[model samples]
Target: MKKLTSIIVLSMAVAATETVNAQTVQKRYEENPFTLVYDGAITRNEKGKVNIHPITYQLNGITIAANIYTPANYEVSKKYPAVVVAHPNGGVKEQTAGLYAQKLAEAGYITIAADAAYQGASSGEPRHTDKPANRVEDIHGMADFIAQYKGVDANRLGVLGICGGGGYTLKAAQSDKRFKAVATLSMFNSGEVRRNGFQNSQLDTVQERLKQASDARSQEAAGGKIRYAGVASITDEEIARTPTDLYREGFVYYYRTYAHPNSSFLYPMSSLLDLMTWDATTNIDLINQPLLMMAGSKADTKYMTDEAFNKAKNAKNKELFLIEGATHIQTYWKPEYVSQAVNKLVSFYQNNL
Candidate 1:
């Protein structure tokens, strides 16, 4: 009887902990419609000033959830420059993407940030699909939707992508001529990392991982069960023990301080089939629009930005700017770094857009 009671008590404690976590997340989300967790996020929309509009649209038969921010005193009759902001991998439209969109709106540009089809509040089945082609198409879909929006000048449309979205933006810009100028912040080459592994740390396991992904795909096709890769949750101790500042801070941003119920690191294991064979730097000469790529000077992922920038041979005008004394995730929410990035972006867009 003693052993049985101990097991019951332990299970009850675990369940209670989970319930509290869930409630906490719910309270945070309810605090703002934007659900923004970053410091200095606008909590309310003011009329005749920067305003946010929650919207939904269809993309390849899937419903996409998005937030569009219009500049102060926006008028449908007057044409204005516009930008499309793409969210990061395993990210929803509400986090850093929304933060940038709000900032750009304040700078007088109409900006829209949307949740990818299989993530966030967007519609999808067997959730958390993180395929590259779908992500690239999501950017295109945003351009299509936002171009027709009131007061937007389709001819002056620009694109700004963050993190993994940065990689997809590069690919989309290669074919989508609508984007007159393109910029990326803290660019993470999803394909390069997925294929070769982070900082080339998993080269030897490439074949083995590919086989695992293939098997997972087969199992999914056979309706056996779905498999997922990546972190769903982490303890504070695990985060403290993380070796790299990028991941260490990333865990805090995504899992705790800025935590959102919808945001997760999980992706279908089968996604590796496409991710392992792709490269963001491929067909490097196709980008003819002006490009501005920014990263933290101390970011571990700065190498990815450097590699992509060097290969953008055909960009009309290209520059790489570094935020001083900042790390990868730091660029996401740190006020000082975020201000630096936004100012550079404002100037870049003003000159080119």
Candidate 2:
């Protein structure tokens, strides 16, 4: 009888332990990981006497949600200079784009940081679709939105795009004279990166990738679940395998520390397949606006920035500023780097606008 009781007690303890472990697993796994925004930043819910509002704008028959951060002491009748902020490839407006918008707005400018179509709080069909033309149109759409706002001076408008957004911004300014001044920090020419290669040399890998994405479309149309392959969550082992450490740094910012409740490390996985065909640098000859393209000296994308700067012709005012010690993602949210970017931008706009 004593042996029987002991056995039963041991079994109960083992079951209880298993139950606790299962509960922990369920709690983490059940909470969807891709639904976060701002990572942990308070940009979306952040308050300012400048009247931050959640607004929606129509683009290509779809509505995109945007956070408009206005000037704190703005006057309704007075027209203020405005700057349109664009987000990174997979990021929403709440990430670095929102941060820059908030900072610029605090600097007494009306800043509209919008989520690209088919992603984040924005509404669109076949979500996570990436067409260079559509993305560029999204930027132009935001410009149109700001141009019609209560206190925005359309003539004094400027543009600031970070990373992939930077590339799209450049393309927008190429033809849209509406942008009096333009700037791109860590600009990524997606076409070059997608076709030629990362640093503009490798080719076979990109070709293979193109074939894979092209093949997947057929499988997708057959009532099949699309399997997206790209960087979502980056583990430490993934970081070590990279040729440069900057990519690892980028992963830390986008996937881990700044992971928003609505920002997904993997939500835009389908966008990668479309990215293979999108190019934001084809029409570089049309940027007549005062252009300021700044990049970190140590960034992996510095080479691409150089290529773009060389291509942008006929711009009367253009300058390329390289910060001494910064990486591609560093300028996104870091105070020291952000301030540097904003200062140059403010100076350029003030003189040009």
* Number of the predicted model whose lDDT against the real structure is largest: 1
lDDT of 2 by residue, 1-353 (tens): 99999978877876675566445534432352322233232323324355566789788898988888787767779889999998887778767887788778878899998888877778875666666777898999999999999989898998998888899999888888898889898998876776677776667677676676667676777867775655655554465576764567766666554555345434333454666666666778877778899999878888888888988886667899997788888878677888898888888878988
Per-model C-alpha lDDT, please? Answer: 0.91, 0.76
Summarize candidate 1's per-residue lDDT along 1-353 as a digit string, tens digits: 99999978877876676567667767777887678665666788888889889999999999999999999999899999999999888888789998999999999999999999899999997799999999999999999999999999999999999999999999999999999999999999999999898889999999999999999999999998899999988866577799988789998788876777789899999999999999888996799999999999999999999999999999998999999999989888899999999999999999998
- How many collisions per candidate? 0, 14
| Residue range with the least summed lDDT across 10 consecutive positions in model 2 | 34-43
What TM-score, to 2 decimals, does candidate 1 have?
A: 0.93
Winning model by TM-score: 1
